[model samples]
Target: MTTYSEEMEKLGQVTIFDLLPPSPSNAFSIGDSVRVVITVESDSESYHYLEAYHPIVLKKRGEIIEIQGNQQYLVNFAGELHVMKEHEISF
Candidate 1:
């Protein structure tokens, strides 16, 4: 069976990991614009192609943020960053 780390690695590889950090507050939601282009760690070489099937869109403007260690900083807007779960982002 795939371990949680394995799943998380796959999630990272996809470049669309979850915001299950301290809490959902660290995560962005619908209507919020994307904060950054996070990278998922997958064995696939063509990550972009994989991403194409699952496009990450900014749901809100202030939903997504960058939390490192203990610092929480909101990501600057670059167009519309509507981020959601893999199922939601993916086609």
Candidate 2:
């Protein structure tokens, strides 16, 4: 596992580890609240909160498609892939 500071460095400028205690990391335990922001960097910065925990795989290039039911989103991240649930960010 990468430390919060180390991951921040890897992400370069797309994210920040701030506004919350860096204990739980990206995985949110029950009753845990956290503040996270992912900036995809386009015309402007995109900021939002990431739900505590639920497995998420991040990759530079991935496939995105919408499924009808059961598995709603099928994502191919890196050479390996997995199923993931939807997530939202708080302002």
TM-score (all chains, Cα) for each model: 0.20, 0.26
Candidate number with greatest TM-score: 2
List model 1 lDDT by residue over 16-82, tens digit each: 3354444444333333443333345542433454356434332223344443333244333444333
lDDT per residue for candidate 2 within 1-91, as digits (tens), equals 8899778777874544464445423322222222222444521222322113322332133344333233233444444343333342111
* Clashes in predicted model 1: 22
TM-score of 1: 0.20
Stretches of candidate 1 exceeding 4 Å from the true structure: 1-26, 35-46, 50-91
Off by over 4 Å in 2: 1-56, 59-61, 65-71, 88-91
Candidate 2: give the clashing pairs: 28-52, 28-53, 49-89, 49-90
RMSD of each: 14.7, 16.3
Give lDDT for model 2.
Answer: 0.35
